[model samples]
Target: MLLPRSYINISFFQPPAFLLIGIPGLEAAHGWISIPFSSMYAVALTGNCLILLAITRTPSLHQPMYYFLSMLALTDVSLTLSTLPTTLAVLWFDHQSIGFNTCLVQMFFLHTFSVVESSVLLAMSFDRFLAISNPLRYAAILTNNVIIRIGIVIVTRATVSIFPVPFLLKRLNFCPNKTLLSHSFCFHPDVMRRACDDITINILYGLYVVASTASIDSLLIALSYALILRTVLGLASPRERVRALNTCVSHILAVLVFYIPAIGMSIIHRFGKHLSPIVHVLVAYVYLLVPPVLNPIIYSVKSKPIREAMLKVLRKKGQGS
Candidate 1:
């Protein structure tokens, strides 16, 4: 008589629920969403490209506010280009097995652009705060030299801060079963779990990155807005206060769209493992990928000047055609 199969054989026969189902087909849903998302990205890319061109081509937009706006547009473009191709490929092919190197590159670009975006937003907030809070010194304080220095800081800080993540991730030893990433892209935390080595250093570094970039930037943004609000209140005209608030509304909405789900994803991935992997991945992309598509539309539609400028550009192109 044949002997009973070993415990290992028995365990192999009944795998974990995740192992059985694999990463759920949520990425397939991303295909359906990709149509609208692609459209949004296309518009955003075009609009931002135009903004950059207009600012560079036009002498009048050489001021600090427009300079910051140009930087914001560039950041938005970077955000789109970083994730859109990989996302589209995953949706198109139904393939989830990303090569280790490719995954790391994607993660690096994603994090780098994300950090840069946050920094640009913070810079924009400070610019607006200064413009409104101290109108007289605004021109003096935000001179071209000062703006250029700040731009360098934004690029340098973001690049330096996120460089360690990919470097540390390269040292991880991933198990065979861990090869399949659950999402469209390689997210740091999700990939880290697959490591066969101690992740304490990685975890600590991640926490440091979050604290230094996201948390600190958010606090500074809030403080800037607070000062802005106080300054707006002092304005004698209710119309002026409303106009000031309106100018900030786009940035406020953009920040909320970008950060809330990001922080939530970080929280749930760390503490709420009981939740579905599919749900987690969905939340991750919605935060990481969605706002870049949403921002241009929101800003262009809400801000009359931008909307008018876009329309004028389009009209001119149409006439030339």
Candidate 2:
């Protein structure tokens, strides 16, 4: 019955390796670039964790909006962590090689967290719409159970959409030796494009997945905001309308921080045709990394409770020290 800790704590390390690429023309600057990237990573990690902690410790933040925010914070953490290691490796140490299965696993988490974040933003929009348009019914409409159910559905949707991608990619033949990737981690589109065999199915399926998940999510979010605007306009009191919209400023900023760069990257990948390598790398960084760093700060500045709670935490730490 005696098992050594090492025996139980085994690691399935990289079995096969795929090379990851740093910024192409800026290879000499990888070290320089990594400094800012590492700083952002520190901010993102600390900020998201603090947000989660503030929400968890403060009983007042247990409402539906904060609950959904907790979801967004969790997603941001996962999204950054999924790719940051390989990214830092490539940028800092030129440790660009990654295993095939590990790459697939990374791709799965990256896409999964991407979809989850999108869904959480949509849910946050819905939360604001309900709070503004029908405050009386907001609680009845989105009870704690309902929010929990929504989160489960969002996670389930992301899992189903992204689960098949790696398997599909596995079936393809990568020819002419080691397949090089454009980013520091495995991107499904980037990986699939390198396969030497027929890729029609992958292309079609990729498009289908995008349309079904992201396209629909985008449309629904826009529709929710449109309804929110219409409802706000109808409120007779100027102060009331202003206050209502004020609550939404942080969410709006979060949405823009996430979607705008993501849209730019999609456009570049699908149609921009001759985008520069640095451009793509920068866009990807903006889309994936910025939100995690910005979201907690946005909420702290915009939401009074979060700011007070964070200050209280810091004061406690100072006293304890």
Candidate 3:
């Protein structure tokens, strides 16, 4: 009987369709392209860390908006920390052969952070919705107790929603080909496709989770923004209108950057396998990881107060030396 090592070697010899895209006969070159992704992640990590530091060190930014922004920064950091190292390791060492346990841990954290991010965005949307829809009650509505409760709910919802995915994936057995996952990490759907068993349950469950959590969050966020727009439009002063709209502008942009590609990839990966794997992988990174880097920069560069706070903190540190 052929050993598992021989089977792995045989599987490695037979590359998937994704490996032949660019450069003829350059299957190994696929790993090289991932370096850019690593660099992007590193930049994102630095930016998020700086934003968190700026927020925590400066007392002037103790308002609710900045507090939410701090939470946003922390979420971004969590997301980057979760995925980037494993991806970079896979790319660098050519170590695509993840053990069953390691893959499960990766999948767990990946989905957990993803769901957390969606929940965070939902919370931010609600924050903006309250601030704009009822300015008089914004303070009363988003008090310390309320914010803490919302934070707990966001964490709990994300944790609970994604717990089943890794558990379900743990029972699957891979056969025929476990070598080529196409993407950097063991994405749930990609891993499911490798299972030797009937995957009808996996597919159905994936669809259910996607529709219920991500799709629902996106819809609610859109509705909130729509109401927010209507409220902002009715304001008498242009300044008030801009101020109200501006509060959500960063979040809206963040939501768009995060959700659009995510929903697109979920559909494409599910229904449109005919598309190029490189395109699919690129889109996945953009959706899954890019926003963590982009969100802080957007808010810092666009919002004068954050930028000023960052600058002030930098200057004080410089002067204290």
Candidate 4:
């Protein structure tokens, strides 16, 4: 509850707790800032949950696209939930102190969900690729059983990949009495750097995981779109081209919304020496926050079935009122 206090290892102590400052440089404004952040989170929760509900209730949305959209909705909720409580607690309630185990748990969930979301996006891209490039075989390729299997593979990939990180971190000793997190959360890099031991393995392992998962996924998604574009361009009718590209609009925006901030944050972390801590924190937060806040809105606007289902629900409620 209190800010994490500095401790000495003179006596036998349990795992050390770390402080979670909401916005490091703007401590005085954390209260005011939480208002907008909380509003975004509220919208994100409402939108994503409604998407899941609409997809479930609407039999027409039983197709692959809507199924993937539902998975994205679920992952968005998971992503929002992974860090929202602790982040808000730090900002609103000044509950900045968190134990080692708690921090590890939070970090694992945050990173795992992120990995899962990336995997889901990759899977969705593959779905689009199949639908566009091989229309005749689309249904055969992306049947319910296949989608279910993809979902299982996604969860398994993320869970297995992230399972070792916290344990890897736990093996290291934080010789320093107190270590501060950059954002209002425990980041893997920040946690790894806190240790006095040789962290080459930590850094290397983290890079390997990112390279194998997120980087590879992004590259493959790009290839998928490139192929999709080639296919779309070959179509004779302008309307067909427009319609095909229109279907990809939401996905492209989703990918850009996710990757741009993510890439920016990474760039800033690596090279933006002039940038302040506030920039890093905000960028990092936005990388996670913006996707959830935008995904449902994008889907509802771009996908006709979802839009109609949403309007239908609204009309039913209006008539009831």
Candidate 5:
């Protein structure tokens, strides 16, 4: 397909289609690498689906904490879907060319859901804090109606915040040879770097969104945990304290599973220029793929209710079969 052309620097450039790169220095092993990537994606898809199924089918999980968890599961599934096609196309078929508008669409959803995930985690931390600090008023504070409003705000904030990114990139002129991206997906930084025009606005706007969402969310999550700790410590019963602390274990694991690789990827991009290209690519893959694959497992092993619900779902299917 002939992509839209941009006349820049007295040269005809197909600025609409950008080529995506598989793992650098490991192109020869992309086929071999895809085995694990496909497996991880499969696990992520199945695990998250089960979480959603369990939440929806089980009546007891219709509380605020589980509501936020269901939101997280949906975001994870959306993130996986957004990146899976291009990633597999690059890895399995060695197909890397992506059209401009399609790339923009992918970038929008990719970033929007990522920010949504961060926001959801922050909300979950708040839910934990409320449950621990004010057990009596937890339901009153985060009622079903309140949770629905929060969900709306999460989606709206992410969409509004990230909506300008593609338009900003659209205004820039991309040079033909510079259209090769570092990863199998179209990332903002990767795509922005290809532009021959000024991108100070794009860079600044990207930073603004990051600061507003992930950075701020991280601080708030920490604050919530600190309060939860204080509240738990004040409890007279040692067993009660342990149980309260234990409730947060799954969330802590989820946060670590998410932010560590995300921060690692950011560090690699900004400071790890001296590192191998493979390192950057590998970290990017982990950042995008790991959390979804592990979150369901974390909750299943930690939260007895969710595990029981999931098992009940499986048994029903088994009996039906």
Candidate 6:
């Protein structure tokens, strides 16, 4: 008995789903691998939630810097949650099938939060520069109204920029039986590569989004820091200079944690074709997982105000319990 022609055509053009590979060569070690990943996800969730709670609860933490930090924490929580379901499912249950539309939804949120995180980091750098460069007007410059507007713009820009991606992807016809995604999550590049149709438009649009968003944000962030250093150098008191730079160390760490792995993963995907599949998958995990897991810890350890607020929050919780 042969299958119907229309059914065959439909299956060819519209694949039922895509297969996600947890870790290509380490299938046997998946159980062991899930331990660390699950732990990191838990940390990312708890830490970011605590940071948000601390910021929202403490009246003293209502400054522009803390506002931006709260935004960052929120973005981290979103980024972590976006990948957690699919990643854990693959690792814990070996459930690899993801519907085509579902894959697109996952890809949208993952990349959207990533871009929002990048933008928030840039905004935080600007906050630092203003605080160090012009302390007198810092509050005036980044008033609550201004911060709110910036937050809106950050989210709107990310959503609008990434909105076209799914539509573009929908137009392409994926290769038959070639729907194996590289990572446990759906990535734009990985999904695009599966298309049997011409993906020139998709590639160009993807590059455009990256260059306009993350690349520009990175350059501006570096410039902001450079000006901050110059301003710090001009101060007569060595102690003042030390204090100023100390304020930036945490933000610098946060930026590095977010960007280094992210850029490394992009480079690996584009240029490290000769490298093993495990290398690509591992780097991808680092890019998605490390920043969210570490950002809260970095801030809590380095920022006294946040640490105190978090402590207060914990104490309150303990008493309530």
Which predicted model would earn the best TM-score?
6
Instruction: Please give the range of 10 consecutive residues that has the lowest summed lDDT in model 6.
Output: 1-10
lDDT computed for candidate 4: 0.86
RMSD (CA, Å), candidate 4 to true, equals 2.6
User: lDDT by residue for model 4 over 203-224, one digit each (tens)?
Assistant: 8989888898999999999999
What does candidate 5's lDDT look like per residue over 122-223, in tens digits?
999999999999999999999988999999999999999999999998888777668788889989988898887888999899889989999999999999
Listed in order, each prediction's TM-score against the native is 0.86, 0.93, 0.87, 0.93, 0.96, 0.96
TM-score of 4: 0.93
Candidate 6 C-alpha lDDT tens digits along 54-101 = 999999999999999999999999999999999999999999999999
Q: Which candidate achieves the best lDDT against the true structure?
A: 6
Clash counts for the predictions, in order = 0, 2, 0, 0, 0, 0
Please, what are the lDDT tens digits per residue for candidate 1 over residues 187-275?
Answer: 78877777767889999998999899989999999999989989999999999999888878888887887788778888888898898
lDDT of each: 0.76, 0.88, 0.75, 0.86, 0.92, 0.93
At residue 292, candidate 5 shows an lDDT of 93
Across 72-138, the per-residue lDDT of candidate 2 in tens digits comes to 9899999989989999999999998888899999999999999899989999999999999999999
Candidate 3 least-lDDT 10 residues:
15-24
- Predicted candidate 3 versus true structure: per-residue lDDT over 1-321, tens digit per residue: 233576565523322211112222344875786667777888788778878788888787776777788888888888788777667765666554556666667777888888888888888898889888887988887887888888888888878877888777657655644435656665788777766667888889888877878889988998998899898899999999988877788888988888887878888886888977767777777777778878878988888888887777778878999
Give me the runs in candidate 6 sitting further than 4 Å from their true place.
Answer: 1-12
lDDT score, candidate 3, position 313: 72
Q: Candidate 3, 256: how far from true, in Å? A: 0.7
All-Cα superposition RMSD per candidate: 5.6, 7.2, 4.4, 2.6, 2.2, 1.9
Write the number of the candidate with greater lDDT, choosing between 3 and 4.
4
How close to the true structure is residue 225 of candidate 5, measured as C-alpha lDDT? Answer: 92
Residue ranges of candidate 5 with Cα displaced over 4 Å: 1-14
